[model samples]
Target: MGRKLQRIVEAAIIERIGPVTAQDLMAMSDDSWGLIRDQITDRRNGKDGLVARCLACECEVYIRTSKTRGIARPLFQHYNGSDPDCPWFQGRNIKPDAARAAQYQGKQESNFHRLMCELVGELAALDSRYIKHTVGQYRSPTENEHGRYPDTYVEWDDFGPFVVEFQMSGTFQTEISARCKHYEREGIPLLWILFGLDTATALPQSFIDVIRRHRGNAFVLDQAAVAASREQKTLVLSCYLRKPDGRLDAPKLVRFDALTVPRSKIPYHEDRIVGSRLAEIEKVRRPWFNALAQWEDRYKPLRDLARPQSLLLAAAFSIVAATNGKGRNYASEHSNISAMLNTYLSTKVLSPYSDLLKQIIENTRSSSIIKASVHDHLRRYRDAIQATNESPEWILLRKLLPEALDPVLREELAYLDALPDWANPTSE
Candidate 1:
């Protein structure tokens, strides 16, 4: 048999508010349950406090906290007795899976979930285009073929239904794949909401896998934002996206009233705009780009090199190359390039001509090009400069070099300049 009925209860509660393991409850404060008290009550003196109303039977219920002897953590219990048909009512013959069929079956929803659901429904109702659409908890038919009950189902005017699943527990890859297939077969688009944590922390592998299945890198909803939305009586969702390199882009607050119903199954298309804005902001604020700009600003007078715009170009090229020409992998590539460039700047010999060659090497390495490939460019540039002293490209490159090593550095910068606009730092 499974562990015990208590284990199921603990799993149910943890599934509602997680990123915290069952063992971590000892560290949780009393206020962790503060948000859920209005729905759940303490069963003291057999009748002192108000009881939670069962979702299925409307019977009174009470929650047991960690203070209860023998109980591990907080769990809901029927005050009088649970209805026979209620999912939370644990019958002597009930199977483990049957007892835990639905995540919120026996328990009252946390305030966060209830408030968010209300706000989301209100926002959907406010849309003029979808004013006629119905938004509420989707109760799958008792004989439902798929056995799927989405947290919130939205019926659009012209588009298909959108199913929102609020994920608070660890999700397995197999489960995610199965759900994706099930929803696709049912002709419903699915949206996942990740609750309780900031994206700066490493996401659960299950959460990441689910997002991947949805063709998204991340789907986050900040609890604080949801609470604020409840207070403002407006729907505001804090969306945090994970880039390809595994860093979260800046969080974007999307107003529910401003959401547009897409022709496709997926409703929200704001991630692309949010990602583009983040990229624009990162162009100037990226650590590697900032480092390059600072280095150029300090050393540009040493040699008559191009302005800091060249460094920006180089930074962009590095990001593009690192992401396999996608140009959107700045988050991880920025750190990688910054480390490599810092090492080169600190250790390399500093003649103006050599510095330019070093910068090119830094760019190549940042792009993840093999050392042998870089050496080929180095050899070709040296050979061509030696063969033709008055080559136009070589003459132009020599102007950027120090007078001391005019002939020594040899048109390497010229070779770099001859490449496409993306490769040349000075080309913009």
Candidate 2:
């Protein structure tokens, strides 16, 4: 069997109304269509309400609901005497791929596409900052830039024209690259919003590749906003993005206007640190601190060995001690730990403390005291920096230390670097 017909048209006394899809008619709803029929009906009442028309030629048509015999979906049908030349006048026997390809190349937009464009355009108009800016399907003002029209364009005061594209189907990678370069040459920023349905499930490779070119890998929309729009008949346009991870981030609504710069900081709904995982990490915090403290207690006897070596070890010990059995103190101790590590890395000639530093590094592998101390310290430092709305690149360096260290120690450092900063602590 062939694919069911998805497209239809509406008829008028003098002209035809559409090549509109059945989905578009569904979105218009029965009540809205009833009003349109009442306003446009003939005075003599001789016509049989609003007449559905054929796309290729003017011919009266009828609605085919889901219950209609032999039809798997809602559609429009023509009477026996309808136009023979009409492309869609025949029943569902056309080739599926051919029909789909034609649909993509056709001028008619799908219901989802039209709705997305309308919502974005509506949001753009309501913002006061863009009140004077033109918002719609933008036609470039110059003859040289003619035929270049974005799906949704907002001419802004500060940034000039901002072009947006909502991609719902498969796209070519070469086309994606060329379009980005074209926009760059034109000095316009092009924002791509992937179809919410696809994004919420799995992103297409084309969308993924294009977004990666823009220095990001994730794009998300709030599920709540989608629900609210269905009920309120208004568009609340906001999107959240991040570097693509293996897992999807929590869904939450944000202001649509926040995406002004493609690479600017976009806030997430929840702090990445406050989940059940953090609670588990908290369980190990004290034990880690205690181990580090005990290590310091044992090393105190070495303070009289030599001034240079003793001072460096003492500073390292002091830094770990300041953590105070809590992850919160890691921020303040960051500089001390950094200075000690830098000094250790800079040491060229072997000395009394060289073996001791190697021992400390080795302990980071099997010693719970060393591992927990490092974990809690880095976690606290991450929370502090993230609280300031900054990326924690400084703490990330813990993962990049020289390979001369034990592999296990390097792995632990990498683990610390990878932990998510879910929530910012209240105290510094």
TM value for model 1 = 0.37
Clashes of 2: 6
Model 1 residue 39 lDDT score: 37
In model 1, state the lDDT of residue 13: 25
Residue-level lDDT tens digits of model 2 in 385-418: 1211121221211222212123454343232232
Off by over 4 Å in 1: 1-4, 8-60, 68-74, 83-119, 126-130, 135-191, 194-206, 209-226, 238-254, 257-428
Provide the lDDT at 341 for model 1: 36
**Worst 10-residue stretch by lDDT in candidate 2?**
418-427
Give lDDT per model, in order.
Answer: 0.45, 0.42
Pairs with steric clashes in candidate 1 = none
Looking at model 1, residue 157 earns an lDDT score of 63
Clashing pairs in 2: 9-53, 271-422, 272-422, 273-421, 273-422, 273-423
